[model samples]
Target: MVFWVFGYGSLVWNPGFEYDEKVIGFIKDYRRVFDLACIDHRGTPEDPARTCTLEHIEGAVCWGAAYCVRGRPEKERAAMQYLERRECEYDQKTLVDFFKETDPLRPALSGVIVFTSTPDKVSNKYYLGPAPLEEMAWQIATAVGPCGNNRDYLFSLEKAMFDIGHEDDLVIELANEVRKVLGTMAKEKKLVGSPLKPLKSQTQPQIPTVQLHLLPPEAVAMDL
Candidate 1:
């Protein structure tokens, strides 16, 4: 059987596994938000980096890349193992229908796997939930870890999306805000300092509702 995985964050730019094909597409009713915390890859436990996770909202459409793995079961197993370790921070493996850009009304593939975190902060230790734009920007600007700084991750995602011809406005806004914070720090000569405390959680803006196009029974089926 062919295995497919959908990437919306760093995986969109740096998929560490081999695949038979990569298709640019979108999933409906889900928006990307930088509310997940990363303490291992691009941050330390004391100062976790904020990363993207899918938030369900009516009418939202998240553009990303869907990778197809075929040929051998061993190869597919290897790919899944790599992703499991790489995306350890995400607490859930969600399956969604993928719609190609050319034909948004119909699904190109079904049961496309997407990694996401649990919404309950108490249940998911790495779930950061929602916060003010400024607070998120600050955490993203200052966090660093074994892999690299958090800002680089944000900027890389921004560039990757732009290169794919699907620029995400929320990503651009947060990246710009991080740049502004970094600029202020540089001017004040405060690049090196004690870690900033995590900001209090803030409510996310309500997503306006819109009627979603109904999918056919075959398209909505999860049995692949």
Candidate 2:
């Protein structure tokens, strides 16, 4: 059986896995949002970096790449293991229908796995939920980790989307905002407001309980 995985964030640019085929496509009813926190890859425990996570929205379409691995079970297993470790921050392994760019109305592949965080921050510890664009941009601009700076992740995704002929508006806006923040910092000859320090006055945003729709039996049956 062929195994399929969907990439919307860093995976779009760096899948870091072996695959038989890659198809550029979009998944329906889901939009990418920079609402997830990363403490290991792109940030420290004290100052987390904002990363991309899928937010379910009506009539939304998230464009990305879909990779399929077949012909050998070991190859597919290795890819899944690597992704599980890389996407450890995500709490859910969502199965989403993938529609090719050439035909958006019909699903080109069913049961494609997508790593996503639960909406409630309590349930998903890494989930940061929504924040103002400026705040997010500030975090992205200043935050750095072992992998690299958070801004690079955002910028790389923006460029990757453009290369694939589908530039995400939200990504572009956030990348531009981060650039502005960086520019301001450079002009000031210092970092902006000591972003590394915890903000005592900042309160956590109220997270609503979002009941995610369950996948069909067939989809669940295809789980790795």
Q: What local distance difference test score does each model get? A: 0.93, 0.93
Instruction: Pick out the ten consecutive residues of candidate 2 with the lowest summed lDDT.
Output: 189-198
lDDT of 1 by residue, 56-173 (tens): 9999999999999998889999999999999999989999999998899999999999998888889999999899999999999999999999999999999999999999999999
Clashing pairs in model 1, backbone N/Cα/C closer than 3 A: none
Candidate 1: Cα lDDT at 135: 96
TM-scores, one per candidate: 0.84, 0.83
Candidate 1 TM-score, C-alpha based: 0.84
For candidate 1, the per-residue lDDT at 15 reads 98
